[model samples]
Target: MTHPARLFLDRAPSPIGELLLVTDETGLLRAVDFHDFESRLRRLLRLHYGDLALETGEAPRSTKVAFARYFAGEVNALSALAWDTGGTPFQRAVWRALTAIPPGQTVTYSELARRVERPAAIRAVGAANGANPLSLVAPCHRVIGMDGALTGYAGGIERKRWLLAHEGVVQAKPMPLAT
Candidate 1:
């Protein structure tokens, strides 16, 4: 059986960059990706949804408000927002586990694997994290390297740093002193 093929798209401006919010006809969020990462978003949707149709439109009012509140530093503004995405069972499990990570906190890939009850699937956890289509809403940016290093983010490491600093998980870099 084939899934429905209807997606709504919206461009929302944020401190980090413009974000593309994709939703279904019923207003369930499907993806939240950076503008520069549009190609990746397309690839992800294509990989999962297969020939879905996209239309430019305003995001749902609640979604817009949640994003506004989130960017305003509420941190948990999006925690309760409803979202749906396509993925395998393992990926779904990993994505569900990701939502349990509180804002301003981070976990290593290995720890995420343990949280998903697949402690031996650290690499699999990382792969699932990499495949996350919801971006900030799923909080994949909260996953870091075991050594406390900022690792790969579909939104780019600099944006990851900004998000971590925004969430108080990491201190922002000090500005240069006047010469």
Candidate 2:
């Protein structure tokens, strides 16, 4: 029998801001976005799982603990949380590549595109990165501009800076321009 689609939402305080966590019934993490952008979170959910039921419930115990640990300076704490990705093939590919970006390290949009084996799709990769449903978990904050400057982040550039600083990547090298 097919299991019913259910999403659980909960709020957790963080150093940057309050976070909105979404998890499936079996405790798989669905999305992690800022609580202030509730509409964006809902829009993402609807985009991923059309018309699914949502309920305000406690986040999974382990997920809560992981977030606590992550905020407590355990950079790898979130790496263990299982994620339930819901996006298009390209988005999924981009998100998967994001996970490979180690904490305390940053990659340019072009570099991310190269990592995903689509070197010519820098703009597309940037779009996918912006559309990431899972924020900190996928490390989308680690993607920077080719000039080693901060760029647009769904959670805000300040939060991105905070996340990178929290991960010990205060300074990043500029991507070498193509010859």
Candidate 3:
């Protein structure tokens, strides 16, 4: 079995603050909290990767390159690169559907659930959305509450606002820095 190990880390300064990006041996893990890298990484290691050891380093060239393109708004599609999104079969299915949601567009959680043939599984769909690991790459931020209000985001609501604003969904005062 492939053991869990830290691949690399990079700090990207954004409008909100400096985001700590982490990746595993597979692909981009998540943008972690700015100052809580060690603690959050440790918790993630235990919860997601079990007791596997972690080593801090630079992000892989491929991922770094992809992120660069993404941040530049020159690329929006991310079918390339291997991702280890730890989720159940149903959740994976939901996340795959999320990727189909084009940039600069938004989808309600209920709509996403219905598209998955899980009309009554709205809450489940939200759970799967909250569990999305690739975050912006997977485009989970595009999902909103039924009332069209920002519901929940693992990376915090401010980041969600930035993502939606970046996509031109809900117009904010000033555009967020890409990526």
Candidate 1 Cα outliers beyond 4 Å, as residue runs = 171-179
Query: What local lDDT does model 3 show for residue 19?
Result: 55
Better-scoring candidate (TM-score), 2 or 3: 2
Report how far off residue 74 is in candidate 2 (Å).
0.5
lDDT of 1 by residue, 80-149 (tens): 8998889998998999899999998999899999999999999999999999999999899999887787
Full ranking by lDDT: 2, 1, 3
All candidates' TM-scores?
0.92, 0.93, 0.76
Per-residue C-alpha lDDT of model 2 across residues 1-179, encoded as one tens digit per residue:
12337899999999888999998888889999997888999998888888997799888889999999999999999999989768888999999899999999999999999999999999999999999999999999999997888888899877887888899996854334459
Quantify all predictions' global Cα lDDT against the true fold: 0.88, 0.88, 0.67
lDDT of 3 by residue, 99-156 (tens): 8898778888989998899999999999888766566667887887766777777776
